[model samples]
Target: MNHGAFRPIELRAPEGSVVDVRDDAPAGAHGEVRKRAVSVALGALSQIIPDLVSGDLCGTSFPNAIGE
Candidate 1:
């Protein structure tokens, strides 16, 4: 998985509990914080998507547009 971009998603536990998960880290920071955020996002997605789809829409296409 890419160690960048923020992907927010909602997850529900087996007991019907819902939680909001997000990757709220600044782009271009390839440190521990950014890695953790990416891991969390990926973990949440793994638990949510039965059959994950791989595509360009999964990340920020214009990463360089904002002067990062």
Candidate 2:
């Protein structure tokens, strides 16, 4: 990937939102936030290029419990 090829991103999320946290927000759970971010970006891109983008990804990494 060419880092210099793309311009810097300027995101403007509402204060105290999931992506924008306060100084004393809860710790951990960054993975979940990252997954949702990717899904959102893909969804936006899908609108312009529907054929290139696939379905939304599963926004989770938790393992399901199996019954005996």
Per-candidate RMSD, Å:
12.2, 5.6
Q: lDDT score, residue 12, model 2? A: 87
Model 2 off-target regions past 4 Å?
5-8, 50-58, 63-68
**Backbone clashes in model 2, listed as residue pairs:** none
For model 2, residues 1-68, the per-residue Cα lDDT tens digits are: 47665455577889788888888986367677878887998799789988776677777876454556
TM per candidate comes to 0.32, 0.59
Q: What is the clash tally of candidate 1?
A: 0
Evaluated with TM-score, which candidate comes out highest?
2
